[model samples]
Target: MSAPISDISGEHKVYLRFLGKARHFLFNLRSFNLTPAEPIPAAATKAVEVSVALGCAVNGTAQPSDIAAAVKMASQADVALVFVGVDQAIGAEGHDRSHIGLPGVQSDLIKAVLAANPRTVLVISSNAPVAINWEQENVPAIVGGIFAGQEQGHAIADVLFGDYNPAGKITTTWYASVDDLPHFHDYDVRKGRTYMYYQGKPLYPFGHGLSYTTFEYANLEVTASALKPQKAVGIALSITNTGRIAGDEIVQFYVHVNGSKVQRPIKQLVDFARVHLEPGETKTVSFALGHDDQALKYWDEAQQDFVQEPGKIDILVGASSADIRLKGAVNLMV
Candidate 1:
């Protein structure tokens, strides 16, 4: 065993199970001295093993006329759930794409489907960014299903129904169009590469996720009025579920320090917490920060060290970057 079975084995009681063992007759294949005339090639054996591990039972595609047929069926229903996006043919390694939209006739299919059924809910499967300004403006709902392997269908269905409350936050900034992105040939990052430097309006900002229920934030406080370079700072706030159902509210804490010695981001995320509360239930959340998070650090080439600046650090807290509901500040002294 590479790391010993003790390091990885689990001991779970299966409904008060009993332990039993059976001894089998030992057979040595060498004693028979039997061999195949032609042994299977190593590549064929590897391919079979790999295919067995990955399996062939994932979501499959429809035929040429299947999309229109699906749209016709969806037109009669109250809600149309449309699953569209790229597959390994266009999104996998060595498969560089020419555009940032849906692959093949998918864009045309989307328009046709929407014309037939306006209440279409689009589930997009992609590893990279794609333009969805039209869908964002017209569609009732859209879910990003980023290459979630085989069981992504279950997750999509659960979110569509009320079985699971969607609370996942996006990590990357998505542009409204491929034109909004800088050319791949341009190495300059100031053209808006990510959430930290992007100045253009995005369809969905970073740290954005829709939930079934709503939340209210109030009672924001800080543990200290002033902070020292070597010391830590703490923040506290309360979140209440205002809607009629129980859901999770991800409370994020961001810090902005002006008068810094170096160029800084507009706001930096320092900490966050996910609190699940029932209707009218309020929960208090707290976060503590170390030196790096409490102050703006700059490289001191003269001393060959990173130095923290003493200044006022503005603390912003809320459900997301755009929805900050609380604000406070603390002075950092040497």
Candidate 2:
């Protein structure tokens, strides 16, 4: 590499500098030696390789093809795992994406492969959400590998082979399409941003994930029916693993103000807990939230401060924001 990589400076310069630093670090770690660039060695020898062919060029220009060879291969295979996603070139910290669909004809390739192989798994590796409404409806299974980094292959392999039970949930709302969103420059989240304010149904809501096993929520309890200012209350619930295998369940807690003078979010996440359970085993999870909890406070533009208004606060507990299973309420005294 040489100096003066770019005439630009500041953040863009910092983003560019990482390339040089990463090159050096990777070389030092013996991962690569690009100085005298040699063909990288294959990680495995026993793995069979197939060339189904991509449906597009690197520049995202679609090139539709017969894809007979790929379809034939998929039809004969026991199961087909179609990997598709965007790269840093398509999405990064410095810029915004133009659209959310699978780049070029990747979606087309997926559809063809899926038609031939019903036992198909759609594995997506991306930094952000992708619009795959068709895949969601038709694909047998889908795995979201959001920028899992270097060891992602091993992680995915373990989960696919049943050696690991994935319980990780999506952190953000995955909208069904780009049309479901407000303008990019709209800084006001109230206009429809995030799980808190978005009104439409999403492809996948926040905190959505499926475990290898199933669990049941029960015995929800709220310690206080009324709360004083700067005071806290305890919330508890019981969860039982009712399936054949052991797995983890993430219990989410959310709140909604029954009646407020000003506009408020539909629902807001307050706290969460994760528990591991064996088949037929049960565990109790609990959380604490004070009247002054930051999550319960709303910004007051006139006062230039955050405040918790006096009202009925509805408590919701469940697997995800959209999967509430228990309900309770408490009054915040004026």
Local distance difference test, each candidate: 0.69, 0.79
Among all windows of ten consecutive residues in candidate 1, which has the lowest summed lDDT? 49-58
Measured by lDDT, the strongest candidate is 2
Shift in Å, residue 279, candidate 1? 1.2
Instruction: Score every model by TM-score.
Output: 0.74, 0.83
Cα lDDT, model 1, residue 229: 58
Cα lDDT of model 2 by residue, 10-125, tens digit: 22211111132342121122232213323345864564453455445422555345455566778888888887777666766665689988887778778888999899988887
lDDT of 2: 0.79
Record all residue pairs in model 2 with backbone atoms less than 3 Å apart, i.e. clashing. Answer: none
- Candidate 1 lDDT, 209-281, residue by residue in tens: 7789998889998988888756778888888999988899888888877797666666778877888998899
Residue 60, candidate 2: how far off, in angstroms? 4.8
- Candidate 1: C-alpha lDDT: 0.69
